[model samples]
Each structure stands twice: as structure tokens, then as C-alpha cells.
Target chain A: MTERWKRTLVAAALGLALLLPGGGIARADSWQDRVSAGSAAATARGTTIEIAMLDRVTGQYRDNGPAAHTRIESASVMKVFIAEHVLHQRDLGKKAVTQTDLADMSRMLRASENAPANRLWVAYGANGIIADIKARYGLTETGPTSNTRYWGNTMITAHDMVVFYQRLMDGSGGLSARSRDWIVEQLRQSVEWGDGGRQFFGLRDGLPREQVISQKQGWMCCVNGHIYRHTSGYAGPDNRFIVVVLTREPSGRGGAHIEASITAAVRAMFPEGLVPRVQGQIGEMWVRSGGHRGPLGLPNTDEIPVRGGAVQYFQGGGAYWSPATGPHWVIGSILQRYRAMGYETGRLGYPTSDEIALPGGALSRFQGGYVYWSPATGAHAVMQPILAAYAAQKWETGRLRYPTSGEIALPGGGVMNRFQGGHVYWSSRTGAHWVIGSILGVYKAQGYQAGPLGYPLTDEVALAGGAVSHFEGGSVYWSPGRGAHALRGALLEAYQAQGAERGSLGYPVSDAYAAADGTRMDFQGGSLTVPSASSTTTTTAPPAAPAPGAPTGAGTATAPVAPSDGAATGGDAQP
Target chain B: MRPLRPAVAAALVLLAATGCTDAPPAARSDGPAPATSSSSGPAPAPPAGEEEAQALAPLPDGVATGTAVLVYSGLGELREPFAGQCSHDGSTTRIEGTADTARIVLEVTPDGARIDLDDGGVRSSSELSAGRYEVSGGHLSLRADMTQDGESTGTAELEIDCGG
Candidate 1:
């Protein structure tokens, strides 16, 4: 074979790696083969554990060990079949299943109340139910106990239990829709039983509330000198699964072990080995997150297909999984960015955290970076130097708040991030510098680089009770007392002519405020006013006059001739 | 699909943020210009020199209290209206409204003014761009444009006395 073909064959072989018991990854033959291996592994350390699973979506039925064929005494779970038979009788008589009957069924199914079960068994005729279930529902391995007095001893097989659940969902068990629903409703009640009743420890114990089976439990101690623990019910969305677990343990203390084994097997069949419980505020947000004509709603499909052993797809988004990072939601634009970065296989690796709520947006942290989303900014990834800078600034709680725009390339090839409070500009020469407060306000108002003050030459510099920032044109000074003021043009020249801040005028009290008289800059002691209309002498001055570069009270005054470049170095200069 | 917009769509003259489809001619806020049904009528000039309401009536009982449902019209379309509140003191006036799923708070004072709006939950505030307040004939009308950060969202016109 060619080298490329050899590599492809090796990858295919690795993709088929089966997660076998005892922490071994064995190459599996197929999905069913893996299921068989898992079943064998589960039964090896047990006495007799039988499990039956039905995938309603694909109409596939699989049984492990002696679960399908072996007949075992159905303890209280037989109450479900008995109630079904009783409801069928009522349906045949064209009679409504009364509220009292529903109450009795609830007691029988939910609480496993023996009084109602015996009453219903006798009312429907114990032998007649067995014959009806066998003939009508085609359940071959189900029959009433030989001793009618012990109604709980009815023989049942895993196959018959699965069939019974199937008929309930398909509405083919000779029971009306209302009657069937009433029985199912009863099964859903009292899922977590108290006071040492058979607690929901089988199929229901291992799943989330939304995905747990509405199941019935059957436990009978010392029945034929063996303890029985069984749980069977329909689970998943729209009752899309029927799972049956029957264990005949030597001692009654094996219920926990039985539950764990069955849970493990069920999880093996699903992606991430866990269901996305989608609950509470997150559920409300997801179901109604999008506006009209937007792409958001409840899950459109029941199966969250496992792709590449990690990522699972839903309607709006999906849950990604990994051994290191666990599982987290990748939704909307964040999901878009994650996919663009090649998902978990790329630089972001696996999502190590769930979508966390921010003030105006949400973020999901990953191994390498984080994806943040806001209605205004959509979603974008923050990684490496930019992310590190944000973290040092305390992320969202700091001055930056949330990123208003992603890290965009500036016109001159530097990088910058626009945030709610300010902007972070980065270049190889300057590392990452934050521009905020009134200085940022002035910079933004001046149309950034597109306006007079090109790019910032230095970060904010500290002065006595104030701070100043240097730009291409001049500097913006800010203080708690004076706000922020920009000094350039003739204003800078006039201020420097009087020894700047040490002279008559203090640090600029305001940026240039317009007035009818002229654009004025206020100072601590007095004010320097520039005339909107120049005097006749200045107007009539010759070409060699200092009129263009001087700080006279004239409208035609220009910037002062000072330093060679008129730009300061990037440093926090102390006053 | 949204409807096509004409060049100069006639707007329902309202207060700064309040809007009503059928504001009667008599419902005109304190203004000098007569209420004209034609869309091309000149904007009523702001209350000239002595036209500002003297007593100001303390804004009526619950006019500035509780919530006022207001509709916002801009960019040639009338968005769905929502409810908010407005309040005024002697020196400052504040009009708060909700539009496009955002809370807009307009605060105008003698010295400085600001208008804040939310994009998602992050608030964006900017200096008031332009404002015209007229209290003519015991009616208060306000027309103002709002700018958040540096971008202009839209204008709001309200007839304050009509409890809009």
C-alpha cells in the first residue's frame, strides 16, 4: 500500500478504538460488538444481571445475557401490566377511566401500593390479564402466578417488559390514549421514594431529570431464596427509549452495584456519556434566545450523535466533550468561531467550562482561550496575548467591561480591541497598552488615527493630581479636578511660552470648549483665550512675521515649533 | 417583510419619546406654531423668549410618575412601543423609555447632559446631541436626538402634557 493509504488505514483503526472495561481501549469490531463486550464485562462480576434496551428512533432492540429469554418473578412492576389490563377492560366497556381508578393506579404504580395492586388484580381477574397480555400485546413470556393469592409473583421476561412499554407509546395495547397516559403519569410520580421503599436506583438513577425514564421499580426479598431488584420504563424525549434492568443478587445490598452497571451501559450508548439537561434559566434563554426568524428553539432531534468521540450536535448548538475539559455548550456565533478554529481538534482544544453569563454577554472558557458573545458584538475568540492582557485587567469586571469588537487589525498593521470602556492597542513595539478615561474619550472623538492626532505615542502619564497621554499632535491631560483637556496648535505654544504648567496657566482645565468669543482653554489661575477674529495688525503682517507659528491672540496661529518630533516615548512619566 | 419607506415619511409629532397615532390638534404641546395636518408643515418654533412655562404645573399628578407607554418612530419605521418612566426636578429633567429592547435614559441639566441606552445589558451613554424644549400654551413638547458613544441612534418627540 502507498504511504497515504497506510496512514488512512491506521487512522481508521484508531477511530474504532473501543473503551473496554478495566480502562482498556480495544479496537472494536462494530457498535453491536462493543455493546456485547460491555454486556459481558458488566455480567462477569455479578450473579445474574440482565439488561434490555430499545432505541425507539431506530426501532432497534438489543438484549444482554439472559435478559430477553429468562423468566423472572415480576415483583411490583407487574402492577403496571395489571393496571394496563384493568384500563383495557374499562375501554372495552366504553366507560371512562374514573378519577378514583386513576388515583388507585397512581398509588399502585408510583408508591407500589400493594392494596391497590391486589384490588386491581382481582377486579380484572388475575388469570385473564396474563391471557390478554399474551394474546393481544404478543408478550409470550408473561403469565400470572400459579398461586393467585400472591399476585406479585407474576412471571415476566425482559422482552415482554420492553414490548409492554412499546405498546404504551404506540397506543396498541387495547388501552385508550387517556388510559395509557394516566398509567404513564402514575409511573412518573414518586420517582424518588422515601421511607426505605424501593428507591429509584435502576435506570432512573443514572440519568438527568429530563432524560430519566418514567419507570416502575420491583423488589421482592427472599423470593425463591433470592433477592430481586428490577426497574423498567420509557425514557428520553417523547418516551423514545425503553430500558429494563433485572438483577437477581444473592444479597439485597447489591442494588447500588446493579444501578451503576446499568447506568454505565446506558451512558456508553450516548455521546459524552451524559445528557444535556437544558434546565431553568438556561432553558428559557435557549428556547427563546433568538428573535423572530432566528435560529433558536428546543432540540429538533432526540439523538445527539457522537462525532469524533467528543462533539455532539443539537439544533441551536451542541455540547463538546473531552477527558480533560469535560463538556460545555458551543452555541450560536461562539460555536461558529469554535468551528472556524477547527473545534476541539484545533488551538482552542476542548471547552473546559460551560457558557458563563456576563453582564451583557456570555463566555465559554477553553483550554487555549475563550469565546465571548454579545448581541451587539456577536461572538469572537480571545486567545494568547490579548486574552492574557484582559485577564490581567480582571476580565469583564475591570474597566474594559466586555469586548465591543474583536481584535481587529489597524490600518497600519497593529492590533487593537475596542471595549465598552476603552480600547487596547497592541504592537510589537509597544506590547499591549490600554487607552481609557478622558484621554480615550478625546482620542475617540478625534476620529482616532483618521483625524489630527494620529496614533498614541505613549500610555497615560501621571502628573501632580492628574495624568497626561502623548499623541502624534500633542498631549491630553486629565485630573480629578480638571477632567480631560487637549493642548495643541497655538494653545500648546502659548502654554509652553509661560513655562507650561509651572507658569501662569495650570494643567488644562478643559479640552477646547467653544464660545462665541473664541475657543478657550481654562486654567487654575486664569484663562488663555484665542480670538476667533484676528486683529488688523496681524492680518496686515508681512510673510516673515511670527504670525503663523506664534501664540498670539489670532485666528491664523498654528502649532508651535518645539521638539524635533513633538511626540513622547511610551512611559508612565511621574510629575 | 418590512414596508418600503418614502423619502420624507410623515411622523406623528410627539414629545421627546412619546408617540400617538391620532394626536389631536388641540393636543399640541405648548408650541407657538399652529397644529397642521399636512406633513410638510414647518416644525413649531421652540418657545421664544418669554414663552417657557412659568409655573410648569409640577408635570401633573402621575405624568412623570409610574410608567408611560411610548412608541418610537425613526429610520422610516415605527417600532413596537414599550413602557418606561420620566421625571423632572427644578434644575434637571429626565425622560426614560424602552425602545428596541433597550432602556434609554435621557438626562438634561443646565451644565451637562447625557443620554444612555443599552445594547444587550451594557449601557452606552453619550452627550445629548440636540434638544428643543417648548412649553407653549401649558403644553410641553420636546424633540431630541440621542447619541451613544459616538453613533446616533434616532430622535424622540414627545407631548409631555398629554401623559405620553
Candidate 2:
């Protein structure tokens, strides 16, 4: 067989494997298949239904067709927007909600009462409420009717409705926690009959009784010879999923017929009468982990299958499961670091252990490495040689401290990881070594591994006053009075000729700077100047015109200049 | 498809007994009513007798009060009567009433009359066939064919007097 055909066959096999239990990845086509079936059922009923659902956990959004984006009159669904706005205002202290107002709001939501809605609509400025709701929720295809008298005519799309519900439930819709809870509570308390008519249809009736749902229903008739029926809400375990279904049928059909069609569509979409699953071992673990209140929080997504295992996300963390490893929860910063490293797909692979707290931070061991996090350094993964070097320093409690950055690859085939105190750079040639303190600063100023200094040949060594470190291209020296500076090429030879740090030149106080003629370096005892060509060196005393080939204000060198080719000219004058 | 002649003859006999002129209701109260009549037919003519005497007879004045009964038998069955009032301003007679959740209004003239009815969530309006009318002893009654929502239902009758 051709290579392409062979690859396709293997891929098909793997896809089938993922469908089996203990397959870590989620079924990608489940929602799509259900949506297609539901759409067909709705069409067969002679009604057009638009559906949009969002799995808050996985952040997966699904729509059956273009109807999801199509605008339809909101009918009584607009009342929810009005209620949210009013409650939001009350939360902001802009509106004082009295007992009467609350009662009316409850009646408005519970029974779909028109009188209360009418009162609130006029009081709140009908169009203004819709505009605020649209803007706050980022509803692209929603707007108030031109005639404010008809609040029910506000236009909305199924997709936008789902987004609104998600945000409202997820605490991102700008409603205070109390307000959101109140609104959700009201929706949950919805009765079978509303002030306008019977409304206990759609998602509420279609889904199983075991599935808890907080919903809003809307219906209106005889507009453009069509009747509108809409049902939307949060559903499933912990209300982790948002479902919105909007439909319009010919006005000649009775409300009961239209309502039944909507219910049929919903039933088709969830034949098993459930939203995304959160049951089995994962459900038990979620409960043990404190469910919605735990560090893992509520499941944001259904259990998703990955290679060899399945993973599920929660509000605060994630849960990973494998047949070999069972199920474990990774929380907080460690979880974030794992995700950044591509979760199980990356080198870190699946986590092998839950977070283990150390003296200064916490860590989670993964198949490939360990992610460590501390209040001071956030989180970073340490692997292989670097990890060994970190262990040598005693981890977070050691001198190296917690890692502040993950392994960063250098231009050449080397890797470097940053820590609170210093860095551990690793390569095949250099293995792994720590660079710390002032000596490490001078090394970094030269561009770390990519700079002319290349890799560090040795760790910092103690001197009489300070320390020094040697690099591939040169060495950096430090002293109590001179800080640190790099010396290389002819400059290094000249410094050695003058007895190096113990000589009259002492330790380099500043790196090389560009002279009018060549390069110059300042030291504690004196300055070294190298002319670019064979030129006469004249030393002019204090505040005098600079030498013909000398740079003006040359002693305050901030950075190293490229080494000149000419021979060095030593000077005894202090800078 | 009831014959129109019989209804017209009954109206003429009532007019002759009341000793009232065959002038349009609007002409007596304010100004002449429009020449248009209900789809049913035109009003009946008076017998040629005592025209001068009929002209000398005093015309009914001011507002008339009464009760209106409506029987609907289309989609469902409903029978209701509303205490009502009517006023004449030479050009036309406007009658209105409300009972329970239903309301009705009839605008009448010598040529024709139209009715607007709102009841049991159904709102409809249609013209009424030219009806027989009697005015005597401070009492007036009108019986006319009725239709609702564009479908013929039955008939509506009103009996009242010019008490106030």
C-alpha cells in the first residue's frame, strides 16, 4: 500500500481506539451527530429550530446550522435581559430594589407576566436595557426593536443567547455574584404555566428529570404570520453546559403544536436526556475534590480523550485519568504550568502525581518532568540535567530557589532555565552549571550563551574581595568596589601581564567602551586603552581636551565594545 | 341567504306604527347620514300616508340607554348581554357597552350601520344588515344580522330607552 493509505488506516484505527473506555480523549463527533439528527427531526415537524450549546468546561461551542446566527424576535426571552439589567443596577446601588420590585421581577420571570414586564420596561427605558445587555454580553446579533413599546420584539440569535447564558452563569457577565445567583434561582423556580400561557416545554420537559436545569422560555405569535418559541438555559451537572433553542413556526399552528415541536427537537439532541457527561470515576473524583467548591471547582468540559488517557478541565484546575495511573487532580499554578507545556501532548506528558507541597512551594511530577511553583517565582518545569542540578541545590529551599521560567532553548543546541537566585544552563558540551550573583550579570550583559562569551566553563569562584567566573570566550571578575566586568582577547592578556586583579590595573570596573581610535577599559587602579591603528598615545590630565585618538568622557563605559585588532596601550591614570 | 324583502317589510311596519318619519336617523339628530348601506340591503320605504303628520311628530332627543345581547356560534358558543347607551348627533347614532371582558360598539345611520366587537380574545368588526327599528313610549329596539371575524355568526338585538 502507498504511504498515505497506510497512514490513513493507522489514523482510523487510533480514532476507533479513542472511543473505547479508558480512552483519554473525548468523542469529538458526538455533539455534531446529535445536532444533525435533531435538525432533521425539527425539519420533519415543519418547524425551523436554531440551536447553540456551549460546554463551559472544555470551551467547546456547537451549532446545528446557519440558523444559530439568524435573528428572531426575542419574545418573552427579552424579559431575562431586562431582569438582569435591573438586578445589575440594584447591585451597583444605582437602583433601589424594593420588596414590590422583587416580587414583580419574580412574577415577571416565573409566570412571564406582561404587566410587570411592561412596568419594568418603561421604567428602565426599554431600548436602553436591551442596548446595555447587548453591549455587556458582546451579543453581536441582538438588538432592541425600534418601537420601544414592543419589548418582546427585541431581536436575538441562538448563538448570542448561549453566550449570554454562559457568561451570566460563569460570573463574567458583570452581574454581581448575588445577582447572578438570584437570577439563576428564579429560573430554576420556573413554573409550568406563565401569566401569558403554558410554558413548561422545550429543554425543561425534554431533558431527563435527573438532569438539573435553570431555564427561561419565550413565546409570541402572529408576527409576520409566524409564531416564535424559544427555550434557553444552563443544564447538566453543576450547570456546566449552556443550551439555547430558538424556533419559529407558521401562525396557523396552535401554540401546543409549536411547543411540542421545540420539545421534540430538544429530545432529539439529547436522546439520553443528558448534557455532556460528568459521571463515573471522574464524577466521583470531582465530588471528592469538593465539586464546585473545591480547588478543582466545577467541570468546565466533559471528559476529553487524549492519547492513552482522558483529561477534563475545571474552573480552577484539571483532572487527568489513565487506565494505568487511575485519576489525579492537578491544581493551581502547577496545573497552569503543565497546560503551558502542552499538557499530556508535550514533553511533560501526563502528570504522575498530584501536587506535592515542599517547604517553599509545590510541585507535580509528570511522566517527563516536574512543574514547580512558589509564591515568589510562579511556576516552571525542570527536566533532565537541569532538574539534576536543581536537586543538587536542594530545590526551592536551596540556593538556586524556585524556577521562574521553564526550560528556554538557546540558539545553539543548549537549554537554560531561570530561577529566583540564578540560572542553570545545559548543553551536551557544558552539561549543566549554575551562574549567579554579579558575575552572572556580566555574563548576561554579553548575551548569555549567544554572546561572544559563549557557555560558562566554570561556576563562580570566590576571590579576595568578590568572585569570578570563566566563559568560553573570556572571564568576568568582580570586587567589592568595582562590581563586575568582562575581559577577553588582548585585553585579557594585557590584564594578566599587569598581574590581573592583583596588579595595578586591579579588577575591571567597566566593560570595554569605544575610544576615538580603538577600545578602552576602566579598572580600579587605572584604565587600559587600545588604539585601533599604530598611533601615538598621549595622556591629557584632568578636564583637558581628550587625546587625539581618545573618546570624550570615556571612563563611564556602560557596555562592552567590539575588541579592536591593534595592540593595547596601558595607562596608569585613574578613571 | 335569507330573503331581504321580509326584513324590510317588518322595518316599514314598525316605522308606520311609531308615527315617525322615514328620514335617516342622522338627518333627525344632526346632519344627513352617509348614503352607504350594510351589505345585507337598503332600508325599507314608508307607506304613502300622513306624511305631514309624521313630519310634525316630535323626534327622539339626547342619549338613549339600554342593553345589547350578542350570540356567537362560530369557533365556540357564547351568549352575553351588556348594559349599553346610545347617543344621536343628527348625522349618526353611536352605541357602546361592556360586559365581563367583552366590549361592543355600533355606529348607525339611516343608510347603514357598522359594529366593532371585542370578546373572548377575538376582536372583529363588520357592517350590519339594514335592521328593523322601533321608537315609541320612550323605548327603542334594533335587530340586525351579525357577522364576526369575516364569518356570519347569527344576529344581535338591542333594546333601550331615552330615560336620561
Candidate 3:
């Protein structure tokens, strides 16, 4: 096997170097020629390797090597046959299969544990099951050694092993479906055993993770002073073929060579050895992240090329593997956020969608809480409440527009966000509500609840030509034609007596523009002049007292010159 | 309504029509704009003396003016929104504004009102950021750096609103 491997490597190298010289004429080198050329060196050293292959799909097969038909020591490969025979007995109710027996079968096939093989050999009537296997499977060269208790020393040829595998795969040869399935399932989980259990050599190591190989390996030292290392398996994405390689290493230095030789031989025979290696950084990442061992498991297909990088599909959300920054998982609303942020290289970077389950709903962290989307909210951010308030009053869309800022915490535990339309204030008490248009402007000028009027007690209620929001100490009344104003104390009573926005005095124009008498609150038609303390009288006059200074009329409007004692009522309280 | 000064008003009409915030600087210096202007023909020279060149007439009473919005590159660079009234306080014009919690300053000279945009490093106008503006009657268009494939790469904008 070692000699054959060296020759194949040399020939493969020659095939490449000969490519340019023999540019047009294709060299059709048969598998036999390749094998024969590779075996010359092994023949000189008296080491012979035998191989038998069965194409389960086409039902055609081939066998080669000096000992191809010669019976040799079976080693642990006999365990596979033993396991099959026991399963058949269990199926026919000749012997009941226990959970412990199944566990032993796993240990035997996977780790090549000997105790389970011996126990099953005894339990299933050893030689009787062996004879049954030989007669039913038509395995001409398979039989126990002279030592009746030793199943490891059972003799078998490569051809007989291939025939046995074929029957096991086809669910024939006197075995039930449950028996074949049990045997194959155990064989598929073969772990590294010899060489301190770190060696995943032979056919298993040679193939990539995408291909499924179910094989039993045999290794024993000093059998007639010859080292035996052999691997026989059914492998392919669909387990479409069976291969048996038997090796007798007298010198003990060529186990790896034989494995490599068999790997190359199978590649030459099958053509598609394994799925083509996935390319790029994402591919490299997949391999690094435990290829088939991680939660994502094996790639079902090749790395699919994408916008910035590539993706390999798996059972879970496949790794958005990349070379640049990270190869992370993307799932759920977090996935929506990542896509909105432009996928991998976007501001959110690679989506590490580690969804920490929140008390209600889930949050996938990203580059920005700047844009958060709840299924209930769609994608709207702050300030919609403010716009919705104005919108209710027929404010034109985008006419009263964009938000000036994100929601900010107010002094009294309420939250306020300003927008082109107006402002939205949210409290645990009043929920989220809006204040906009002229009424909003008046509310803002009155130090926004820190003034004579405290936090809003009610949503704006519409009047004839305007809207009004009642506050802790006052009411902000607004009219389109007259603008917004705060009417409190004597001023509010006078304004209420005259009606409201549709009153004889009209909507309050300025908040409280100061007058010489004291503080004068204006209206579209007149003014409510709260007299100085010395006079103690409130007078009503036409809007001609103090000068209307600027368009945004500057005023020291002191809501009747009284310091309002309204509580900071919006703090977590129901308004 | 307050009456606008005749001289300043005429210049303002052209400035407003063109959205010419960086006009005087571009017109005076041998920058990218001046070179392009010179390439079209010869750029018009400035008024002779520096003081005369810098001198600007007082804005009409009750009229709102310029706002200073800053622009800078690199990490940790702050940007305050341009919002408030651009007022003249005798020799030096002090225009203070606020956007949300951000304090904005509009630095005005006789030549024009401009916010000192700190670009952080040496960069041409082509490498600078695009800015947003809310001006009364001016068309303020901002351009930013383009990538190797001719796609714009910078995220920050150079906002300059000449509205009070």
C-alpha cells in the first residue's frame, strides 16, 4: 500500500508535468495501470495490499492485489460481521436484544473496543452466528480461526468483505431492515481509536466532513510478526459504494501510506471523492469553527457566494462567516436589523445574533439602538405621537415634519421628544400623548410645565376654531388665526367668561405680555390685564396696551404676576 | 415689516438665489471654487482694503440672519445643530441657537456669516462631508468625498443654514 501510494503521487505529478507537452492527446490511464505502477515497490518488500470495491449504484465491482483472493487475519473487521449476526438473532426473537447490548455494539464499532465484541460473540452463540453469516452472505473466504474463542483472528479475504458490505447495504443476505440499520448507524459514528486515540487516519481522515463514511477499521500488533492495519467501509454522500482495503505490513512502517493509497484509489474509482472544498474566508471560517462538530454542523452544499462574502447552509441559521471582521450567526428581528444596517460590512458589523431572551420579547444587540423595530411598532421611531396629535387635527404630512431629536428624559420623570410638528411627552401615568401646533408653542414658552401651568392633565381637546390642553395650574388655548396662550388665575376666569377660542375676546394671542399696570395676557380681540398688587383689580381692554414688540412678540408674561404652586405632577403619576 | 437696507439687500438677493454661504471665501482664496471660477474666466477681485473687504452693512431691524453649524472629521468630533437667531451686537455679531440639547453658534463677519467647520485634517472640498441646511431663500447644496468606484464614502454632512 505504501509503495502504491508513492507511485500514484509520482504518476499524478507526471500527469501534471506532462500536461503542457502532450497538450492535445489525452492519456487514458486505467485504474489497473495506476495500481500496478504503484504496487511494484511493495511487491519488492514482500508487503501485499488487497482491495475490493462495489459500486452499489451500478452493481459492478473490481478486486486487485496479490492477496485479493487470499484469506488473511480479520482483526477488528470481524466485529462488523459479528454485530450484524447478533442483530439478526435479536430480530428473529432467538435472543432478546437489551439496551446494554446496543451500547456495547456502539462501543465495538466506533472505538473498536474488544470486550463488547467478545461478549456479543458469546451471547449470540459465536461459531453458530459465524457459520450463519458465511453461508447466508456467500462469503467464501470468511471463517473463524482454529482458536474458537478468538473472533479477532477470524480469516477473511477483501472480496468476501465487500460482498458482506453489499448485502448489509441491500438489506439482504438473511438480515432484517432493523439489523442492517443498527449495524450501519453504529459504523457511521467511528471515532479515533489507535495512536493514543488521536489518530483519525485511514479513509476517515482522507475525506472531507461533507461525505458520510461508515467503516470498521482493524489494527493489531505482532500477528505472525506482521502488523495488520485495514479499513473497510461504505462511503459516499448517499453511501452509494463499498470499499475494502486489506493490508499485511511485515515492516510496520506504512499504515499512513496504505490509508493514503486507498484514499487515492477510491478517489480514482468514484471520481467525486468529497464535495469540492468551499472557497474564501467564509469557507476557512467554517472549517475552523469545528467543520461538522459545531451546532451548525456540516455544510449541506458548497459555500454560496453572496454580496460581501459567502454562506454555507446548515440546520440552524448558517454562519455568516467572513474573513474581514467576524463570522457570526444572524437570526430573528436581529437579522432584520442587520439587513437594515447593510449586512456584514454595514455599521452593525457582523450579526452576532445572540438573542438574550428578555422578560417580554427579545433583543438582538447591534451597532445602533438608533433604529429599533418591534413587531408591534414596525419601524417607527420617536416623535410619531407628536405628529399623530397634529395629524388628528389635519396638519399636512411632512408639512409638520421630521423629529428634531430622539426622546429625551424630562426633569419630572416624563419623557419628551420634539419634532417639526410639535412635541410628544410620555409618562407612566398618561401613557404617550402629543402636543403640537400653536398650543405646543405656548406650552414650550411657559417653561414646559415648570411655569404657571404644570404638566398636562389632558390631551388637547378641540374647540370651535382651536384646541386646548388643561394643565395643573392653567389651560393652554390655541387658535390658528390667533396663535397660543396660557390663561391662568384672573386671566383664565375672564377668558372663560368671554367664551374660549371662539369667544367675544377671541383666542388668547400672547402667553402673558407684560403691561405697565401689571401683566397683560393678550387675545385676538383684547387683553386681560391683571392689575398691580396695589390696585387689586383685573381689567379688560382692547389689544392696544403694551407694544406687540416682535413677530415672535417678546414678553415677560407672568401669568398674572403670581408664582404658580402647581406640583411637578407628571412624575410617574397618572395625569 | 422692517425695511431692508438697499446695499445689503441686493447682495442678499444674489446670495439667497445661489445659496452662497461659502461664496466670499471661495471667491477670495485660491481654493477649488476660485480655481474653477478663474477657469471659466478671471475671478472678480475683492474690494481693495482688508477692512473694506470685511465690512458688511447692519441687517434690518427684526430680521433673523445666519446660524453657525460645525463640521469636523475623526472620532470624538462633536457637531451642534444650527438653529438660533443670528443677531448683531455692535462690532461683533453674536448668533446663538439651540437644537434639542445641542448649542449652536453662528460666527458672522462683515464678509458673510459662517460656522467654523473643523475638518479635523487636511482635506479638499471634494473630500469634505455633505451638510443639511434650513435657509430662507438660499439653495445650500453640499458635496462629499467619493470612493474609488466613484461612490460617496463619507457619512457626515456640512450643514450651513443662513436663516435666522
Best by DockQ: 2
Tell me the spans in candidate 1 whose CA falls farther than 4 Å from its real position: A1-45, A55-66, A94-103, A140-150, A191-196, A204-213, A236-240, A251-575, B1-164
Model 3 chain B scores worst on lDDT over the 10 consecutive residues at B145-154
Per-candidate fnat, comma-separated: 0.00, 0.00, 0.00
- Superposed by TM-score, candidate 1 places the C-alpha of residue B126 at a distance from the truth, in angstroms, of 85
Across A479-537, the per-residue lDDT of candidate 3 in tens digits comes to 55455677888777767776654555666767776788887886666777777564354
Full-model lDDT for every candidate: 0.56, 0.68, 0.52
Q: How far off is residue B44 in model 1, in Å?
A: 92
* lDDT for A352 (candidate 1): 80
Question: Each model's TM-score?
Answer: 0.38, 0.41, 0.33
What value does the lDDT take at residue B11 in candidate 3?
Answer: 65
Ranking by TM-score: 2, 1, 3
DockQ of every candidate structure: 0.00, 0.01, 0.00
Q: lDDT, candidate 3, residue A310?
A: 61
